[model samples]
Target: MAMTVVTGSASGIGAATFSALAASGREVVGVDLRDAEILADLSTPEGRQAAVDTVLARSSGVLDGLVLCAGLGPQVSDAKRIVAVNYFGTVSLLDGLLPALRGGEAPAAVAVSSVSSTQITWADNPIAGLDESEVEAALEVGGDYRGQLAYAASKNALTVAVRQRAGDWGAAGVRLNTVAPGAVDTPLLQAGLDDPRYGEAIRSFVGPLGRRGRPEEIASLICYLLGPAAGFVHGAQFVIDGGVDAQFRPTAF
Candidate 1:
């Protein structure tokens, strides 16, 4: 059976993807903070190392697919934690698992970014050119608005990183891509809705569809991207945000 690793597999889109893959007879290894085959947080370096090591052991150093769904929303209080989990966490895991992916048959990896990436203003964006010290520096001065900016910058950086590494990944026979979803009805979305600060703003951008997307919908697209049919689709960001982005920034993206 094809073996796959899915981060944030305990909830939301991650859970949905895990279910779909397992139902299709794939041997899936789930990584999450709780209720998963590999219970480890992605927000810390040690936790990321543990998750990678456990997955490598389970897959015997061979992985057929990888899905990076672990992330933090803008509503999160700590900007540093948001960048840590959303950007560094995803990048670190992908880098650590590259060897296994290269050893597999027709390997592919997908990361979940957000539509917020397109919404970010380039000037003074903390997420750009992120290095260890730069991320720390940004965290030190990040306040309420900057926290949201951090989320956007993290996703933007993630998308750009995946695209930039496409050539290298392709040479290794591994395809890398990103998925940007808009206002998806998940635990993350519910949290945003519950927040009085950004709830109304979040609700206002439902796009032409006029409803939040279900996790299954996004999961289906992710599964497609991981399959053999999507062999030619690499280093691309597929946005599944109803019409919210188009409605507002139709010409920009």
Candidate 2:
């Protein structure tokens, strides 16, 4: 039986991905902070462990795929919370799921990153070596800061980790990669879209695509990457940002 694990399955891309995977003939175990069958907080060690435990239990001690879709875009009062959920959360969960992945056939893990990370230059990362506590300490600088930088930084870290570990996992016949999504119309985007100024900017930013992306569109690509179709693809970041990244953000024309 093909068994897969999906995080952040309560709503948005995670929920849609879970539904897609389930429909693909894979027995999926979804992990969320809500009161779902596979409930767990990705930011907590205990919660991450619980999610892995549930997957193992359901899969009879193995897992075929792991979808690391649980993440946030700097909503907390502190930026550390963003790193905790987006960066460290992904690392912790992957570590816990490694054993189960090793036992499965052609195991693949897809992490959901963001197009926002493109702004972060890979060479000058300050938090690259910092521990979780250090990350928490940095967030102590409170002010009008929105933690948007932290959100992009965290995903940058995740992208690096995925690339770094791909070779190691490939030795074990497992593939690990990341998907960087553009502006999508998930409930999570409501917080930004509700703001008049921000909403107007975002609406115009998704140019050419003409609108925010549907969750199912992203889910379809994720599913394809996890399946045999992307057999040769590994350790790469797939950008699904609808050409927004190529836009002229600093122009007056």
Candidate 3:
């Protein structure tokens, strides 16, 4: 039996993914600040470790799949918090739980990146390989208002990191991949859509698919990627946008 751990399972995409996985008969462990078996803020190293400990404890030392869906977006005002939770928090959790996963049966990992990662370019200036101290230093440079750029950069780095992790975990029968979702109908999206300043027009433009994505839609993909069906797929980032990225043109071509 495959044991799965899903972060940010309190609500939104994470919650939906958790429900889907559980329905599929996988031993699912859902982690979140609210209903999480492990209660710790992802912003701090201690918190990240605590999350790992909880998962191990809950699942009894065997981890077959890990879904890194817990993340914060640009809507967050605090830039350092964003990096801490979305970036470092992810890396920390993965590092702590990887050893357990390596010993499991056909272990696999999936991270929730963002479609925004596709909009930015940060090739030479890689976000991975940096220590926690360095991340803190970068946070200082990023300041309190790193905005969308920082969010996109962080997610982009996450995508790249997943690809690289495949190489390291491959020999151990562990596969790693990422999912990048577009505008979805979640609390996060509703909040952003409610912001009169950033909502209306943007929603209209991105909703060419009729409307924003439902949580279940994204959940389906997460479940599929984590299942045995995705065996041959590794180190890839699947963008779940409604043809928005393809149609997006800054100017008439």
Candidate 4:
């Protein structure tokens, strides 16, 4: 059976992915701050390291899949933490878990990014090449825009990192891809909907499909990428937004 590790397994897409993978008969290790097999705060250096160490130990230094779904929305008050968890925390694990991925059978990884990543301009987003500390310094200010910028920029940076590294990982017989979902009805989306800053805006903005995505829908895509069917797909960023991306910028993709 395949062994996989899912971050942010407590709820939302992460929880949904965990359940979906287990339902398919894969051995899955759940990692979250709570209600998971491995508990760790992915926002901090120590916490990310701990999550990595625990995953390697529990998986016996071999893993067939890794799904990174732990993230924060723009409603989060701290922009720095957004950068930390979304970019730095995620990339750290991508690098840290490479050895285990190499040791497994048909290893593949999928990360949850967002359609909003394309909305941010290059000039405003500094997370592409900056170190963790430098990115933290750049987003030190406190505000909704700051949080929004951090959220988008971090995901953009993460996408870039995965694409750039996909060739190397593929050479090692490990496939890597990312999923970008728009306005999914997850707890994170709920947070934005309930927040005073973005609630009305979120409720008002509808995609061409006129509905939000369900967590199972996104999880199904992730599971397919990890399975044997998508063996040829590599380093691709799939935007599954129910036509939102298409409606906004059909020619851009």
Model 2 ranges with Cα > 4 A deviation = 139-143, 195-201, 248-253
Candidate 4 on 1-253: residue-level lDDT in tens?
5579999899999999999999999999998989999999999999999999999888889999999999999888878888888888899899999999999888999988888778776666766578787876677553447777788898888888888898899899999999999898988999999988889988966788899999999999999999999999999999998898888797998
Error of 1 at 117 (Å): 1.3
lDDT by residue for model 2 over 29-104, one digit each (tens)?
8888884568778787677777777777878878899999998865455677788889988998888888889998
By lDDT, the candidates rank as 4, 1, 2, 3
Worst 10 residues of 3 by lDDT: 139-148
What TM-score do all the candidates reach, one by one?
Answer: 0.95, 0.91, 0.89, 0.96
In the range 1-253, model 3's lDDT, one tens digit per residue, is: 7478888888899999988988888888777788865567888888888888877777778898999888886767766576777778887888788888987888888889988777656563335566656654564544544545557778877777777788787777888888888888888777666766557745764734766688899999988887789999888988787867667843521
Q: Give candidate 4's whole-model lDDT.
A: 0.89
Clashing pairs in 4: none
Candidate 1 local lDDT, residue 171 = 95
Cα RMSD (angstroms) for every candidate in the order listed: 1.5, 3.0, 3.0, 1.4
- lDDT for each residue of candidate 1 in 24-44, tens digit (9 for 90 to 100): 778898999999999998888
Candidate 3, backbone clash total: 0
Clashes of 2: 0
Model 4: lowest-lDDT 10 consecutive positions: 136-145
| lDDT at position 74, candidate 3 | 70
